[model samples]
Target: MTGGAVRPEGPRASERAARPDGALMIEARSISYAYKETVALRDVSFGLPKGETLAVVGPSGCGKTTLLSLIAGLMPSTAGQLRVDGAPVQPRRPGTALILQDYGLLPWKTVRENVALGLRIRGMKPDAADQALREVGIADLAGRWPHQLSGGQKQRVAIARSLALGPDLLLMDEPFSALDALTREEMQDLLLSIWRRHRTSLVLVTHSITEAVYLGQQIMVLSPRPGQVVGLFRNPTVGDRRAAAFHEMVNRVRDALEKGVNGGA
Candidate 1:
């Protein structure tokens, strides 16, 4: 008890205190990868809380897609670790799913069949599979084939298929990036509605700042190649997309992204 003075923990301690309870739904810690000598990710770390939507945004070749691939277990990271709900992610896990921009629907399968594929694999009853199609608002199109549907319809089917499986986490890679502005907005709304009902955690990788702001409770901005989290923004004003507060948050994210691009932050 001489003269030693105890010091309080600082900002990092406060940051840790703010984390959510329960195991993270998904975690990427010190995740790094390389294609030969070209680095893809460098010490990138982030976590998704249960029922939260975390959006990842960055410039081209910034490892956003690579991160998604790693999370989906399509490819292993060259270094670091990835976990899905406290367990190490494997090459494939029934608890997670991915939706790509192209929809990835099987052309030969009818809408209902396509949406039911996951359930079918899991041995769900045929009627239950039909119910999943209805849940996604595509029941009427159940008999239609992929080629017979519009782009938005096809994407909905893809989403329906993913939801039917009731996965704990959904990974989407620019799923709406190719749609027209109106369709994109519609798809975003549909996605949020489904997520609200299902309460599944989502991790979406996109290049659009507005999309990220519209969909994510928290947005993570990554630096160029060998991507790292350059910025993080949390939008406390959930929903009410038309509200001025929502627009303000969107602008904030947009400005931060612009600055990151210009300053290489």
Candidate 2:
């Protein structure tokens, strides 16, 4: 991935790099969650610094999506504390967006309408939605309905909708799992480009080790159901999946997941 011409990290990343390293955008302390009789997570904790990315990877039902929901304030953690910008996370928290694997688009709405839907909450001008579509390279398809688009295009609409809101924190739960391998790779690259340009804080929940190592600044592995933090690996140079270190990091995360599932964490 690094073979291409070297590019700048963009002004936002450069500007954000000047902030104190200890300045965190989100902090989870011993967070635990449950649904009636089922516990999904336990004593899960991590700190995500401003403008950095974290990828949560584990086996099925490891509370990866649950963690994203807690951060997005979709549901409250049954125990412990989850804070965004030093305050308790709340529903509809300002500057937060969550993208799901299903694309979450309304079949009845046109591409432009779907993208414009979220922006309507802020009374943003139509041009803002148009810009978002362009950002995702889907501007030409604005008039088409969701059913008229391919899986990748539909996902692009979901991304455009979130970007239209100009979120500072972006949470994604297997957002690319449904796409074909080639499309998934394209979307991954597009996502990283957007992240660098906007410097938004990102947390992705995925099952793919290669995907985790490719995009995560901090890769966290979780144990089985009633998920617990097994290990956290830093991958500062993970921008290029082709790099030797990227593969090495993927192997490390894979081992951690295996150990975690077997109660070795």
Candidate 3:
């Protein structure tokens, strides 16, 4: 917890958690995609409830990132419909935020500048961005550049940048893949803390079973190449990552992934 203790009460509770009636925040049906002739995803379908997380785990080149990109509106699908917050997903929707493993920060910009970049692009003031720096516990380093920061700090800046937008859905593609083990674990806790506070729907694309089980409320396992959903499991250790149930679920996901990869499901 490099950042100060995560504030449990952030903004509004309702905004953080979607209604308890199980309202759907994202719906994807029979979605398929291809790069010209090479297929990336095929007939993939899943629904994500508001304020919950859906962690996608699959073999390499299994279309995990492709599926995320489809949901984020970074690219269009070849078939099927996707709706987020009850509306069709469009390119670069203001209500959605996407973070990648590369950190995606402009090297020229300072930490504060990077965090405030999104708000500035949206023609919003820097007040929220300033608050975001405080939230991520990098207020003193706001003047620092990306090269001057550690991997964890850079990731925090990236997270802060995304939070500055106040997104309804936060999408991450192996965002902590490059961090060291200890830093990665810390970042995971930091992410969960923020998610608990904001209640914003999150979709994480990761290769680590431990990560998927520890952070995901629901886990989606896709088959290798031309990926399709092979399994979906409801994780029981949402609030308690130290529980036996969490490790059990990790093994389960690993087993499912093995089966998916070996059986070519």
Candidate 4:
């Protein structure tokens, strides 16, 4: 896939992957948020090492998605320090991409156009879009309109768009929630493959416990509204769902989630 991805060529991807030289990729300290009177998140602190994946899981309205926005620099935190790549968060920082739950595609754009959109904005060769589409196994669907694709196909286009931009920090807010079970599994496997190859820092917010355990090397659980960090689990065996202890980790996360609901309420 020789194309217009930034970060330069040659030894860069290795340098990026080797960036875990004792520095965190993401750091949040005493992060809090409120909408005038309605508090959403409170004192949430966490650190994500470079090239690792984190999954945030909690009940609805726990500010899980809001946390992603904060990390993406979409909005400032109400209080505390938040940094990414050792710098203060900035809106739409280069090499940082957010994938929304709703697919976020322009209805009028073909799959190819949608994939090329972010690249063009970044001054990259939009022609490289085809390579991204092929990466996600959707190059054949490039000419099709969004409405013509199935839910899973639409999600593929969305993933291709972000991959096209060659993001270093990938934040996904329930990217697979809209898909059926089989398709969701397929997409999950595809994402694991991509992560293995690219080694990007990933943060995913989802409601599914199984999904969290499957993908997150680090799993964070937030409490209900006025969210707080209630639990954080380390899953060394991430991506191996058939492992003997995989279900055990899921149960632990489930228990922590219930604790959040009961104590938070």
Candidate 5:
């Protein structure tokens, strides 16, 4: 269930050593997507280094989820290039996992079954799935159905489902937006802890300013409607979410968002 080994001659392996400790996990260049006559994204470009977290923030209907879908290999770009683990992403790429806002669990499935779904799809046993549930602190509730779980518990199941696959890259679409404040904070802490332990590359799409600054090592700001990369802010306090430095970074991201939404390039 690992991301597998990287061959010396493989796409990113040639200069993997020279490229910094964590090489690029995802690279998008001049990417664009359209739904019929409406353009969703345009000229969006960014590179996420391995083991880092990237947060994408933008106004509503700005194609944030669309970008995540593209990276997750759910769909292809209408124009430009998208690569995951240095290879062109295609449908169901093993190195990527996506956690949607709705949890995406089958209502009739028990918690354990839901978590085991992805692993089963990859032809792996349910061992990793059980391990994932334990990691998320829900091993005791594995038999509970989705209807029997609270919002936070359901989200944990979603996270565990993704983690069970051991994906090198995890794509999350506002996974905490629906939780209550206290629950959301708890989930955020859980995510940070899991991220520190797993060191998996993460890209989260969120509209919350505070959440973006707290979780993202790099915050990418996008414009309205026809989304584009208006700015990309690198956070200095990667794990110090409550520090003064973290607040400063948040202000910087907020300013960038304002400028970008106000028509800055």
Candidate 6:
């Protein structure tokens, strides 16, 4: 599932290192969403600093995915504002990219072709598309179909495709939830490595507190249905996932989620 290569535009520097002063990249001001009679989000507001990873965690049906959709412009908000780089986000924009839980690779296409699909859709040449595959380290599996690759391989391809676009903002929706423990860890490490190479602001939604702590410089815990941000924690000493401080932050987030589910916090 490798993505095709793009000409690599936008800001330079590794994604995490690029935000020296921590300027805002994505902003949600009093954002709310509803479906028919059901309220999905309620006055959820947060700011994602450029080149930083912000992980959203909450119980099932907490509108985590809906929030991502709003940020990605997959759907319109019923109220409030959603912005990217200070401007309203538009779906399929060059400045942002999305990676779904399912990988979303076309079964009929080979790994290379699937990776290149985005660029091809954007009207890029074949040569440039091939280069994107190489950037994601799936060049060897370029000709293989999605069914032929392992779960981790498929995820790598999905990520490669996203990176090939050189997006300033990257949205991920429980991307590793479907994989086994070992594979999920591998994917996490791979993602950190890639983020180091390309400095994209990341907004990842997940149920795992541990996963959130491992990847995010900042973590936001949302309450149950009609989601609202209940708690926020920042880890200044990121990258040391095993540190006591990191574990403490993880426990705090987990407690917040449990409290939110039980209507305590």
**Candidate 3, overall lDDT?**
0.84
Write down the worst ten-residue block by lDDT for model 4. 1-10
Give the alpha-carbon lDDT of every model.
0.78, 0.84, 0.84, 0.86, 0.84, 0.80
What TM-score would every model get versus the actual structure?
0.88, 0.92, 0.91, 0.91, 0.90, 0.90
- Pairs that collide in candidate 3 are 16-198, 16-199
| Backbone clash pairs in model 5 (N, Cα, C under 3 Å; residues 3+ apart or in different chains), count | 0
Highest lDDT against the true fold, candidate: 4
List model 6 lDDT by residue over 56-108, tens digit each.
89989999999989888888999988888878878777878999999999999
* Poorly placed runs, candidate 3 (over 4 Å): 1-19
Q: In terms of TM-score, how similar is model 1 to the real structure?
A: 0.88
Off by over 4 Å in 2: 1-20
lDDT string for model 4 (1-265, tens) is 1111012111234434554555678888888999899999999888887787889999999899999999999899999999998899999798899999999999999999999999888888997789889998989998999999999999989999999888899999999998999999999999988987888889999999999998887888988998998888777557778877788989999988998899935
Ten-residue stretch with the least lDDT total in model 1: 1-10
Query: What's the lDDT of the predicted structure labeled candidate 6?
Result: 0.80
RMSD of 4: 6.9
Model 2: how large is the Cα RMSD against the reference? 5.4
**lDDT-better candidate, 5 vs 6:** 5
| lDDT of each residue in 176-197, candidate 2, tens digit only | 9999999999999999999878
**Which residue runs of candidate 5 sit more than 4 Å off their true CA positions?**
1-22
Clashing pairs in 5: none
**Candidate 5 local lDDT, 136-169, one digit each (tens):** 9999999999999999999999999999999889
